[model samples]
Target: MRRKARRRRRRRMRRRRRRRRMRRSRMRRKRRRRRMRRKRRRRRLNWRLEKRRRMRSRWQQRKMMRIMKRWRRKRRRRLRKRRRRISMMRRRGEDNEEWENEEEEEKNEEEA
Candidate 1:
């Protein structure tokens, strides 16, 4: 009877140790899984933010290009109008004095 009791006590102790070890391993696995999940979520959010930034930059670039094109077109129109006026003055037999006066008036207007 003494030998039997000793054997039973040893078996119970072994089983309790194994149970504790299994619980510890399960907790470790759960913590590792939670950490992986958090990392994935953060990576996804960062990717989305980067995509939005790129898209916004592209839109701004397009808007600037459009504005520049419009400004160039207006400059071209103004130059054509000036050339037409100069030709008309020359056809009317106007001298360099009138042309110089017009240039001074334009300069004053620009300064104002």
Candidate 2:
């Protein structure tokens, strides 16, 4: 009777241990799966943000180029006008000192 009781107790303890190990393994698997899912979502969001940033940079570059082109065209027109005015003044035999003073005033106005 004593030997039979001991054998039965050992069998019950072994069964309980097996159940505990199985439960622990299941919990670990669930935790790992959740972590992987979160990581994947974060990566996707980062990729979307990167794409938007690249698009914005491209748009800004194009706008800057357009502005530079317009500025160059205006400068060219202003230079042509100045050359014509100087030539006409020369033909009219205007005083050189007066023209120089006018040029200095124009430069000051532009600086202001």
Candidate 3:
């Protein structure tokens, strides 16, 4: 009888230890899942930020292109007018007429 009671006590102690180990393993698995979720959230946020930066750069590029096109057009018009005025001055041989025409062009430019 004494030997049987001792065996039963040892068996119960082993069962308790196994239960504690199982509980600890379960907690570790829960922590692993939380870490995975956090990593996924960070990746999602980084993707969004990258997308926003791309869109902003594209918008800036488009805006710069528009401004460049406007400047090119204005430059082309001024160059054409300057060429016409120089030709007219060579034909007329008068500095006053060239100056007066330049002033008139300024009025047209202001209207535009």
Candidate 4:
């Protein structure tokens, strides 16, 4: 009977140790899940930030394109007027060296 009791005590001790190990493993799993959830949230926030940055950059590019188009139209109109003036000066049989220089400069600017 004493031997049986000793065996039972040993079995009970082993069961308690097993239960403790199980609890520790469960706690570790919970901690890992929490850490993964935090990482996912951070990734989601970063994705949103990146999307916003791209949208802003695209908007800026569109704005710059519109400004460039407007500038091009204004330059063409000015060049047309200068050409008309140069033609009129030529018809009047006037020395147009200054106008010719200006026209050459405008052409160079357009080439650039």
* Best candidate (score: lDDT): 4
Which lDDT tens digits does candidate 2 get at residues 26-70?
A: 999999999999999998879745555565577776776677689
Worst 10 residues of 4 by lDDT: 48-57
Residue 72 lDDT (model 4): 92
Name the 10 consecutive residues with the lowest summed lDDT in model 3: 47-56
Assess every candidate by TM-score.
0.42, 0.39, 0.42, 0.46
Which pairs of residues collide in model 3? none
Q: Write the per-residue lDDT of candidate 4 for residues 1-112, one digit (tens) a residue.
A: 9999999999999999999999999999999999999999998879745555565577776776677789999999998888899989999998868988988988997896
Rank by TM-score (best first): 4, 1, 3, 2
Better of 1 and 4 by TM-score: 4
Q: lDDT of each model, Cα atoms only?
A: 0.79, 0.79, 0.80, 0.87
Report how far off residue 50 is in candidate 3 (Å).
7.4
| Residue pair clashes in candidate 2 | none
A best-first ranking of the candidates according to their lDDT comes to 4, 3, 2, 1
- The pairs that clash in candidate 1 are none
100 Cα displacement, candidate 4 (Å): 1.6
| Superposition TM-score, candidate 4 onto the true structure | 0.46
Tens digits of per-residue lDDT for model 1, 3-96 = 9999999999999999999999999999999999999999887974555556557777677667768987986677567667877889988866
Candidate 2, superposed: residue stretches over 4 Å from native: 48-112
